[model samples]
Target: MEIEPYVDTTLDEPLVPEPPEPGSILSESVIDELNMTVWTLSNGVTVWLKPTDFKEDEIALQATSPGGWSNSSLEDHQSAVIAAGLVQQGGVGAFSTIDLQKALAGKAVQVSPSIDQNTEGMSGSASPEDLETMLQLVWLYFTSPRQDETAFQAFMAQGRAVLENLGSNPMAAFADTFSVTMAQGHPRSRPLSVAILDEIDLETGVDFYRERFADASDFTFVFVGAIDLDIMRPLAEQYLGSLPRIERVDSHVDLDIDPPDAHIQKTVRAGVEPQSQTIMAFSGPFDYTAQNRVGMRVMAQALEIRLRERMREDLGGTYGVGVTGGYEQIPEESYTVTVAFGSDPLRSEELRGVVFEELRKLQVEGPSQEDVDKVVEGERRARETNVRLNPYWAAQLIGAKASGQDPRFLLDTTTIDAVTIESIQEDARRYLNEDRVVIVTLLPAEMIGRP
Candidate 1:
């Protein structure tokens, strides 16, 4: 029997479906269990501990150092971030990565580093039996960061390989272009450039670790889960107390947020996926504002719904669309709403226009009662769910308190219950003005150098 030939016609069919957005109405009981304890060490290390009363076989630990790109040079910041990846690769004191692995072998201890634009730190989890060794490892990375040049170059080479392959990824290109356009000339603007990577000589790595990167004064230690203040205090005093007090350099540069004179389209074509991406950035007020934060949360939820309905359901553009606010605390605190969607380059202009029109509608006419209620309900549910799923929510709250932001915002029933619809409309009116927005379009490189 001969099988019939098949012709693929699915491409011509509309792909996205209009599904009811999940959990539109939030419940109240999820908000009750938010609790935490904060302990301040004599040496200035703030610790946040939240115990799991039911008793898990293992424990997780996480600590964050708040001073990120705002506190260091682009090159040094990159070096410090990248160094976190390389720290265990070399070794500390007398141990190599291999030796350290062998030491922790068969034990429930694991350590890793996480670096971000505004923070750099390490985290680990261990069995109650191995907590001391876990903390010791943490101390090693913070105190003696072994910046071996050979290992760093090898790591950089691997990074270059990954970057070269990212040439084809539409999302990666969008991210690259967005960083350049939004943060140009600012410390936040700089990504690891080829030129900078090329200049990473042996001395660069050594000086980065020994001098500017891991200063004790810029560090904050946070421990969560099954920790005793008395037992850990001496260990902390010994491991962390020895850190020298040194004045570190600050990395801040001035940049403007006003919309560009003309809308611009940029491209990075040398990649595997030659698709186009659009990034819609609108002015958002500083995040610390109670009104703005509440407004921003509601507005973001409203925008997410708008994008889902308009782009995914109405236009059938892509599988997903995301909108997030870029809230920075240093290098001058500011805010921006970045929305990106995946699509063909030919439709880039249409996508941009539709997004702007949506923004205009929000500015000219306030969201409907239904839209406002839906967002408020969605955000309230989200905040409540987070408090329940992660016990570390308490640590995060306490950390915010340690940094001077009131943690009460999380637990304050008055604050959560008091978010008014008028407050949402007021923020939209104040910050969503088109004059303050920047529209950036990034397309494939082949499509570029043509128009």
Candidate 2:
């Protein structure tokens, strides 16, 4: 007997026509019609709600607090991290870790907490039906955290174990070592040192959670899904409204450490791999800056094109290359462009010279119209694809509004179409000059020959 494949020849209804081209300057009336809705809760927590009538069953909610390692006292920075790790582990209100797990097990509710250079945070998801339970758990986790001493000690031990493992891991060690060589004395350079574990104690964890984490004014709640604003409004008031008042809020500090015009090369052993690559990182402009803002983005994309063409395609020096610019809100928001790849042990300096040559060319002649048009078209296609693929893109718009950006900026083409060849040249001239580049090469100990 022969089996045949079956085809369902059904055709779906067409979608509404795509919006008009966003090339020209966007007007206030056009911006006003953009569908990003935001409101402040009675508890002083700003909430951005985006209603998406997508077909997906699950929704993602990301709520972030503004102060991470940068704002905390160096001693207390890791403490902030410690508190975040134990958020769900130490139990909230009457729910132990096991109990919380059991309550949401089959329902697909997840709560995770993390801390970074700029913010300490918790965010997770629940089914649309469990939104109330999700918010309640988050509120209790933030407000009535137990910070059990045993759990804190266990986590500290785990952190120390992880650091010891990093000593044997080349990639992990590169990040820490290169970060120190790049930013040096700035707050941005501060890594989670192994010594941070020694400094951990029960009292410190409790203090960081109670004195630092409990402040609701510093926190924001973001809910995105098939949400009913009327239903969630009362739930927000009942759960989040009761958080302790924090009159004083944590503020951002700048980490603008412009490195000197020198090449720094170093070598170390990671007890594992004998070979690894180095990363050359340079600071660029923040997203909200004047011409420098979007200019830096175009510049980074242009550099990626050059790097891919010269380093990968032409010379075959490395497997891949990437350049990106993003707004990292604090130690004060700034832009960074990093180029990284594994190197042949002997060709490390040669690779460095090639990189400098490409950057120099960019600074001098500037990119061609063909190059500019390629990136503009690529960026446009990527954005359109992302907007169509992810329903959460709408939620991202709302989150950006809550984070204090004009939501219409996403819909505006001025950022991309306006990125002219001259603009890219100007930004490269400003930020990627000889004095601004910090070249960090991590080679094997034996390969550390003079440049």
Candidate 3:
């Protein structure tokens, strides 16, 4: 469908609501160690305040909840994706996207909502003077999200254009194949296709987004940067506290999206270049503790060092390689470690063998003290830098609260010190099971004897 060009002149002026008055604060406390304050608002919404002088005039805002695609049904997947995309595209409250832009022309503020596999949240930054404007925008998103059909159609048109020739891209095809295989063919795991784009309903999409963001009581708002609690408390009470509250206590349900339990290998022949991409993935359930999470990171860093030495430096099979470890609290607390790289098709299998060899070595002999020290030092430096940034604190606070963890865990730097080489080796043995691995190799058509 061809969408009519949106003309700003014909649209009516947007109805901007007045800023809410400061509401009553029920309770407040400070964590002396972290230098942060936690406030329980009269409306039951928790607000975290961390005053920092890192950016003299900037403040970061994050509003998070535990419900996301996990709160959506399989049938609503397409709608949910479209809804989240179009929600901000169409604008909030009575403002059209164009008008909203005009309204905030001089303000240094940004706010957008997102729905992930297991979480939904909004993140943006604003100048200290524009904090009330930021709160007002947040209130609008929660209370009144305008659905413009024209914006939805335009978004879908752009999306379809991007997906029209996606199959022609060999790397894209390989990524889709890898996702499908790893997700065990779960419907939600399927990559977006042109057909799925046509299946999305605008009304359904809007409703799905609204349902997930309906209740404000379950939401936790975190604000960080150069701001005073005395001044912020009243603004938070008026704008955030005045949001409509509902009694819904929805949380993400585990959809049982697990990787295959047995060893599985898949090879795809595509593209014309004489290159092959390989992903060596190992995944399983894990205890979602701070200590365990740190242990997994240590293992990934150590494994990357070994792979670089064997695969890139010694054998010269690939230019570079990467090892990534991820832990998810929802869907039953699990961890996945993926080793990915690209190389000549002829040497791909040889490099793949080396990947396993490194894992086996870690399982038996464990990472060297030198390797462990390198990872620990790198982590320490990163943590030290992150603690001084407002964006980092915002993310950490929201994540910790959503996952039912102590916010002090973010301030605790001792976990890295406690991650011993033995713990990393144990993690390797427990998580790197050969039977539970999924290997995907994408080779050139010529290499696989295909036209």
Query: Could you estimate the TM-score for every candidate?
Result: 0.76, 0.80, 0.94
For residue 294, give model 2's deviation from the true position in Å: 3.6
**Candidate 3: where are CA atoms >4 Å away?**
1-15, 20-22, 448-451
Cα lDDT computed for each candidate against the true fold: 0.58, 0.63, 0.85
Q: Return the candidate ranking by TM-score, descending.
A: 3, 2, 1
Candidate 2 lands at a TM-score of 0.80
Of 1 and 3, the candidate ahead on TM-score is 3
- For 226-340, candidate 2 gives per-residue lDDT tens digits of 6676776666666666656667767444445544445455664443334558677776445554345567777888988998899888987788777775555445456667778
Name the better of 1 and 2 by TM-score.
Answer: 2
Using lDDT as the yardstick, the better of models 1 and 3 is 3
Instruction: Kindly list the per-residue Cα lDDT of model 1 for residues 1-451, writing each as its tens digit.
Output: 9998995332221111221111111111211343444544443455555555433545566666555433445556455545455565666645555556666668888877555445555667776777767766666665555655566667778868876767556666557666666654455455555655564444444444444335554455555556554665555555555444455544333334233433445555544444666667765347564555566767766767787789789998766788875555544456777677877777777777777777667766767778887877776788776654333563565356434676556565455455555565566666565666566566655764347
When summed lDDT is taken over every stretch of 10 residues in candidate 3, the lowest stretch is 8-17
Where is model 1 poorest over a 10-residue stretch in terms of lDDT?
Answer: 19-28
How does residue 379 of candidate 2 score in lDDT? 72
Q: Largest TM-score belongs to which candidate?
A: 3
